[model samples]
Target: MQQKISDQLSTTAERPSGRQASSPRAVPVLTLVSHPQPQRIGERLLLETLANTGRTASLSRSAPEFSRPGLPPGQPLADPFLSRTPVQFAPGTRGRLRLLVPKDGTPVRVAEEPARGAREFLPEELIAGVPLVLAERVVLLLHLTRVPEAPVTQELGMVGQSESLRRVREDISRVADLDVPVLIRGETGTGKELVARAIHQQSPRREGPFISINLSAIPRELAASELFGVQRGAYTNAIQDRLGLFRAAQGGTLFLDEVGEAPPEVQVALLRVLETREVYPVGGNTPVPVDVRLLTATDANLEERIQRELFRAPLLHRLAGFEIRMPPLRERREDIGPLFLHFARQELEAIGEAHRLTVTDPRAEPWLPAALAVRLLRYAWPGNVRQLRNITRQLIIGSRGLPHLRIGDRLEQELTVDPQSAGSPHISGFEDTADPDELSPSRRRPADVGEQELLQALRASAWDLKATSERLSISRASVYLLIDKSSLLRTAGNLSPEEITRCFHECQGNLDKMVQRLEVSRRALQRRVRELGLGGP
Candidate 1:
């Protein structure tokens, strides 16, 4: 556990500013990975270390008890779905854990494989975290983490029990009072802007207005004036003098979202501002001093953009006085259940259906099944929490007046990865030891796959042609061939001008979104957009 868990957290002895320490000390805990009842998710059981041989898990009050903080302490699993016969977990020396699955009880699956009678987990496997599927009723993750931190709050407004997010919180607390510029980075919809707000709300500037603007959404020509104000009569549309976001956020924070997309000239202006604490209006020569705290966020790979000469290196350095990274939702699957419920509760309340989640009878079947929660947990979540919110909203609306959350027929199929097969083998930071059978879906001959499989593959791959080909274990050419043969599939060649034009505006000239909407090759989509003169390079 010492070596492996240390590897799990950090490489070197020095703890990176926004990362965890290299200490081998970690607490082993069992997280309620998923449940039909969403509130129970993320509850954990903390185990003692080898010094105390860890706490032995056993049944209490006729059911296996898992707590609000973790296993072994507080709450009880009074739910009736669990098998009465207890599954005993005994801890041994040097971080070893022995499990005894009752003969009459449903076989406990460890990392998706059934443990016949008894099983022993080595320290390394426990450090990487093992998923235990109990009677198909609930999922639990047995993993090591640093000591518990404070829970999510109204002020911070982030959710998760993962140590990674804990480190993020620590980063926020450490920097909030320093008055230093902070740069946030993460995948889209991973809540980089939310983190920026958290910083602003917690900082000394909390009383002042926290203004935020998306640099990418503003036109290139107008970006400078938007950020640094416009002098009256500067342009035909400049009917009056305007105070830019810098002055508007005086004595507070101005969060520049999508800072990587800042225009070339705007980048130079930003660098000047960072160095001088001043801004020059669009038509004025004199620089106005600013007293606002600067925070910026981006999901782009600015280093790559710098290589292309699209962004200035000096600006990148200035924006990144201190960097905080928001880990994607997939990296912390345990948070998925909590986050989904958090988002779902709002929609459910809005529709006046809040009581659907409340359970009066323990014997009654849960409206939201554990199996469906597993599917949600196993999803890739490329669009992160924002996409999860959309899916939650979809379930709430699409299933209005239903007995349960009626997962759409299409979404049900798309999320149909086998319970025993998907996401059981690996955690994000651990080494990949994926089963060969995991890739078996691709082993089926491309010709044998039906139109249904093609569409499913396209959806799963986010309409990426190369990824789709790899998913089916076929060549790129075979994917194109399948598209040509399928009557339902559409490519850029066959797309109507009106459709492309509509998609271009709706997606705001984002090619990736166009690729997803049109279900066509990205390169081909770009060519068609250009040929039609829709917009963008």
Candidate 2:
């Protein structure tokens, strides 16, 4: 299993020199477990076909080690290129792979050979104790010449192309050469983890482990042990000594996610870890030395918490060595398309599905109808990248069942509206009683709105989230949530400026007609009109 993984590391012909440092020896081993083959009849034939062809085409080869100039004639390269080891499955060796099905029940292999080019493919079925056959003559590529460039960026699948993202990337590039702690702030689902990964991937420590710890995921009692390591018999339930994230990430990067959720006691330990490159594990007498680049992220406003004395101000100061604030999805409309494509491609590849419509392909652009685009643009994605990924997954799964046109329309409709029942009050708590002029018609704060307009745009676009989002110049997912939070539809006696103006004009300034349309008492309408600067002057 380890050998299979090692071979796959350098299989890709054009990975960047930095990212290609060393592919995980655990990849192939994990892939077999994660993507298991079907267990139906003819599984053996499918496995054989894959073992003969598919895996080879998917492999990436590492680049040759380059020697620096002025080196002695016979000096070796700084980093020696790892040689590929020959892999022999041995006849009748079992394997497993995910079976492709035109429909749900019938399964077929997308590609036949599961391994090739000095690499072995572990079929999922063999891992599951099922017997399988391996191809006798599985020809392999030994060592291929390096290519000009890698086709994909190491950060390819991450979402967002907004100015905010670009700026964040710039910050990361700038910080790569330094050893300062970084604090990433964003709302939930804003891809804080991705930002941390990008920083680590681009830094000099790229070759080392990029360890992450979710402060919220660990229990308060165990937080100390998890972050600072624990000795055997440290306390009750201490079965063995354990190396914590800090030690595991020595000479690399350590990312603390949801740092605000950490308890006060743990915060002190973390501060000490940051100040001094030392850690005192539970039940240990002396502190161990550690060298790690620190990265922290939080959805909550740590500053506000600090002001309220909920969080230690000194700790906050320590973590904010460099801060990068991310804008919500609604704030950056231009990045929607690129983000959509990024997630779409990742989902398809993960599930072993063909490209329904590849991004960057002009032909595929036409397939993503203008209406769909508008829907996507108009809606606001409160859940941000995560919601978008989930929606894209649904679209892929749904496309398999319905007609292409219907599927697109269904997607459009869902994207625009609430995806629940039609006529769900657009937003709640927005009453018609307020004066029309009180709500400025001009775009005072384009980035901040109560959410009604976003939902209306969503419903108007037939729940085609992308199209609705575009029409409103926001993210589709955001529109859906805003409608729920704003309570626009459920609110009673609420009137928009346009609705009041239209009714007043149609009524020819008649109080009765305007009152009926506006759904307010005559006295209330008069007061509103006066407040709106529309009453007799």
Candidate 3:
């Protein structure tokens, strides 16, 4: 057998502080999304600090070695199909990375596009995560891990390592023990209730029952009585005296979800409870003193509601004593793999299909393909964590008794389609073009999309040029034209050779600077420079 040839990216050097470093201070990391070898799933490789500008790092078949998180440094990824040649990474000016892939090396795809020659990735792109497919079998995500959020000792019952989640956890730790009304804010399905639960679990009221109520789900007439206690015959069907959510959660916590949806009467009643620390039961004059702590959550715009007078100003001030924002699933994408696995394990165990994740055959294809995983990572996740959890459940249950997890029409719809319902999936956006290599900018339907929808798709696709095309139902060339037309995006291809050459020297030949100034793709600009016969910095 050939010797165990170990290959890895060089250790990166420490970076300077502030935006000079990574603005928010982040380091690049490589996570194995999945491989045909199921054991490689979720393994991580932390690309270390590059000591200086000139020094660089690399990745080949054997690159992610013993230094791989949770693995011994001496042990390399023993995949037999990977190429010996490496894809290189070097620090660019201002916290960006210059990437190079050899033409002769194993085939590589960046964001599902062929990765040939050179490219550059901004720090923001790293944060959003850059997906790489190697040799068509291995998938790795290059993303940023902001400093200080590098894994803590306790799990805190949360399943992600993203920086946003770390901040949310920190808020919980700081405000949990304090006696205050905690308000959790975020979009729907972003897990506002989870944040509420975490606070309650960590607070002094942990021992007491945690009562939860959804104000939006309750009828307006019953809302007040439901929140406060209802005395016998308070209204029809009010059988006996009832203890309200506040009294039921005595010495514990009362979680008011969808608090923005609280009826006008309920809002007034709630503000009084916050002021008096007691409730006024319906059909009674006596005030019932309650020791419950309040934790309310909302996806609605409470301030807007206040502007419209649908919600009371006093109530808004009362609920937001301490605010904790639950990040949407798209914002905390790095946690998706862990969160998916957490959900998958639960569902698999529930149906006695835990073994489904691991196929014994060495030659079998991975049930969860890298393409699917990358799609999951790149998806807008409009439904947030709840959406992802539901998708995970669907992927597992819908594939029952199958060798691989089946992505049904419904599951695929949930996975690939956007919130605006971009409609059905086509065979390929690249199809129907006469030139094949290039589609005209003046093509039909490309100009029909307005600026806002175009911008929306661009953001939703994380500025991926190809992805934006798919989202807009247009060709790549048309997408570029639309981008060039918009003030938001420009292409180096649009700039003249002379203009690029002049800027190249003005920036002291720093491609990163040129990228910032030219407002063009760094890779595209780099290529243009080479085409112009201007050299690298």
Q: After superposition, how far is residue 48 of candidate 2 from its true place, in Å?
A: 57
Positional deviation of residue 471's Cα in model 3 after best superposition, in angstroms:
22
* Each candidate's clash count: 5, 75, 10
For this target, which candidate reaches the highest TM-score against the unseen true structure? 3
User: Which residue runs does candidate 1 get wrong by more than 4 Å?
Assistant: 1-24, 33-37, 49-64, 70-72, 89-100, 107-115, 118-131, 148-155, 416-537
Across residues 1-537, which tens digit of lDDT does each residue of candidate 3 receive? 211101111223445543233333356777777666654566676656442224567788776562334335643445567678888776653344666788888787776577777765544456556777877777777777654334466557777767788898989999999999999998788888888888989998899999888888998888877888899987788899999788889999999999988877888888999999989999878899999899999877788778888889888888889899888775666677778777888999999988866655545576677678877876666577888889888888988888766788766754652312211111121111224332345444554878788877766765555777777776654554455446444445446678888898899998777766775555556766876779875
- Top candidate when judged by lDDT against the true structure: 1
* lDDT per residue (tens digit) for residues 1-537 in model 1: 432322322233555576755453466667775555656676776654321344456642255456664325555556566667777666542234656677876446765467656565544445435677766666677666665345544337887767778778888988988788999998788999888888988898999999989988999988999999999988899999999989999999999999999988899999998999999998878889999899999988798899999989988898888999998675576667668767777998999988876655655555666566656765546477888898889988989998777798877754543221112223211112323532355455556878889989988987777788788876454565566556567556546689889999999999988877788767767766876877664
RMSD of candidates 1 onward, in order: 10.3, 22.5, 14.5
Give the least accurate 10-residue stretch of model 2, judged by summed lDDT.
33-42
Q: List where candidate 3 sits over 4 angstroms from the true fold.
A: 1-24, 51-54, 66-75, 93-95, 148-151, 358-364, 417-537
lDDT string for model 2 (59-109, tens) is 111211211112222211111121232122221212212222112211211
Which 10 consecutive positions of candidate 3 have the poorest summed lDDT? 422-431
Instruction: Itemize residue pairs with steric clashes in candidate 1.
Output: 44-70, 44-71, 45-70, 45-71, 48-54
Give the C-alpha miss distance for residue 362 in model 3, angstroms.
7.0
